[model samples]
Target: MTLSKKIEHLEQVLNQPAENFANSFKSDIILFFDDNFSENNTQLFFLNDLNSKEEIQSWVEILTSRFVMKFEAEFEAENDFINDYLENG
Candidate 1:
């Protein structure tokens, strides 16, 4: 998938109702990065002007590792959501 499509997928996942624990966990990841990278509600600064697949993957990898490390217990139950979000792109 293209970067744009991946972003769209993220939005799709986030739009789902957080009625269950699994969906809520996915929302947490999406919301964290969305707020973390937001600047006046614009594109994510680090993700903006990306030029290659490696750069995108690297960014995702770094973010995923850091996020997982910071929230290991919560991430353990829904690791695949992050993996799919990053890798499917």
Candidate 2:
């Protein structure tokens, strides 16, 4: 898939509700990089193509930050629910 398509796929996955969010994210990211490596002929391209490597690195950083924010928000919401239940019960 093209870079845009891959990004779109990631966005889609990010929006979906997953029973296991971390595992889902890991599996999707692994598949995304695997496809990228195949498209570039191999992972060695990362070593030779500075621009491509930088672009991918940027994306990884952005994605990781987003994932962390999302996970934290979810965790806080769940924690709040548990606290409310305990207080009310």
lDDT of 2 at 82: 25
TM-score of each: 0.36, 0.31
Model 1, residue pairs in steric clash? none
Whole-model lDDT values for every prediction: 0.50, 0.43
Q: Which stretches of model 2 miss by more than 4 angstroms?
A: 1-28, 32-36, 40-50, 71-89
- Which candidate leads the pack in lDDT? 1
Per-residue alpha-carbon lDDT of candidate 2 for residues 13-70, written as tens digits (9 for 90 to 100): 4445545534344444445345343334443233232244345445444554445555
Per-residue lDDT value at 7 in model 2: 50
Query: Backbone clashes per model, in order?
Result: 0, 0
Leading candidate by TM-score? 1
